[model samples]
Target: MRWSHAALNCGDLDTTEKFYTTWFGARRVNEFDLGDLRIVFLRLGDAYLELFGQARPPAGETPGGDGHPVAGTVRHIAFQTDDLDGFLRRIEGQAEITLGPLDFSAHIHGWRSVWLRDPDGVIVEVSEGYRDRA
Candidate 1:
């Protein structure tokens, strides 16, 4: 079966929506108010991300941490791009670049990637030449 969509529990829907749209070119396709929870669906090319927000504010810390994954962790959300350099330039000063725009050619043939953190500190990876590597 093919992949459908991924969901994220966001603290602020507007901020999260702007982040994805501004950097990754995601467009809001639909939204719903489900009594206790509110959700917005964003379409990025063929894929989708559902952003969920609760009526009550978050009680404690978010699910993931900065470095090193614990068991059963869903490390990061990755996106592929044709022009990595141009995308990097577009996002300058918009968010923090947490990790490399480094080369992965040694391990993955022609692959190169970079990592950035969203407003809520969720890791987002952007890569190029993944099809060749795959």
Candidate 2:
């Protein structure tokens, strides 16, 4: 099967929407307001992120981390990029880059990754040259 989308709770829709759109080239495809909850769909190429507005960061989560993956809870989402350097340049001063531009060529051939925190402190990973080893 193929990937479709990931749903996340954001502190603010505007900031969350802007972050994905600007840094990841996502565009808003649909939105909804169900009285107390607000939602937005951001299409990034074939996959999209479903954002639910007004969520607070959990106390246990670090600003940029996997946050103790236990059971079925969602930890983070990773994206594959074509130009790692160019993507880094785009996020330079605009976003809070948590870590990397680290290489993992030894383990995964040409794999490399960088982490960034979303408005809600979700650690999102953007990488290039990642491949499955068989």
Candidate 3:
């Protein structure tokens, strides 16, 4: 089986949508009003990333995080592509990379990743790995 879509709760749905659309190429496929707020569905490749304005925070306390796994947590969702550098150039205005295109050749032969954030402070990882795709 293959992985499907994921959701990220945003404080401002329009802002988050604009950021992802501009930087990551997400396309809007559906949207619905929920009386007090709204929900938007975006398509990114074969996956869907849903945005909910009135989404409740996860149970229990979250440190300084924006209070959701998708909002802020090292458990970030990643995307893999062959043209890592080109993709980085396209994301120029959206975020600043914090980590690497650092070589992992010593540990793993075909793994390189760059980390950055979305508008809601959600970390996103873009990686390139030849072996895995092979």
Candidate 4:
């Protein structure tokens, strides 16, 4: 079987929705209101992404919010780009540029790649030459 969907917790539902739509062409497919918070589900092609508010602790207990980096948990999500230069320029203002569109001659079969951090500090990769595999 194929992988179905994945999710990321977003602090701002609106901003998360807009980011996905603008950067990855994801369309909103569902929404849920939890009184204190909301969740938005977005889809792009066969992949799905869900954004939910951070969970709160029980009234009398402390929040179990971990103090580690989210990027360390799942590595990253990558996107294939036809125009790596233009894509980098477009996201320059929106996200934090972590790495370059440097040529990865060995690891990526001579493709160019760059890494960016999303609003929640999750790693996102933009790479060329992925289309060659298709």
Which one is best on TM-score? 2
Q: Which sections of candidate 2 miss by over 4 Å?
A: 63-71
Instruction: Point to the candidate with the largest lDDT.
Output: 2
Query: Which run of 10 residues does model 1 get worst, by summed lDDT?
Result: 59-68
Q: Summarize candidate 3's per-residue lDDT along 1-134 as a digit string, tens digits.
A: 97677888887788889977876788999999979979899898889888888655446653232224555455676777787889888887657665676767666677778877676666678888746433
Alpha-carbon RMSD, candidate 1: 2.8
Per-residue lDDT tens digits for candidate 1, residues 24-106, read 88999999998888899999978899999753454555433333375775678999998899999999888888788888787
List candidate 4 stretches off by more than 4 Å.
Answer: 54-72, 107-110, 131-134
What is the Cα root-mean-square deviation between model 4 and the actual structure?
Answer: 6.0
When superposed on Cα atoms, how far off is each prediction in RMSD?
2.8, 2.0, 4.4, 6.0
Give model 2's TM-score versus the native structure.
Answer: 0.87
Measured against the true structure, the TM-scores of the candidates, in listed sequence, are 0.85, 0.87, 0.75, 0.76
Residue-level lDDT of model 4, residues 77-122, one tens digit each, is 7778788888877877887777676787665575888877766665
- Clash numbers, per candidate: 0, 0, 0, 0
For each candidate in the order shown, give its overall lDDT on alpha carbons.
0.81, 0.84, 0.74, 0.72
In model 2, what lDDT does residue 13 have?
A: 83
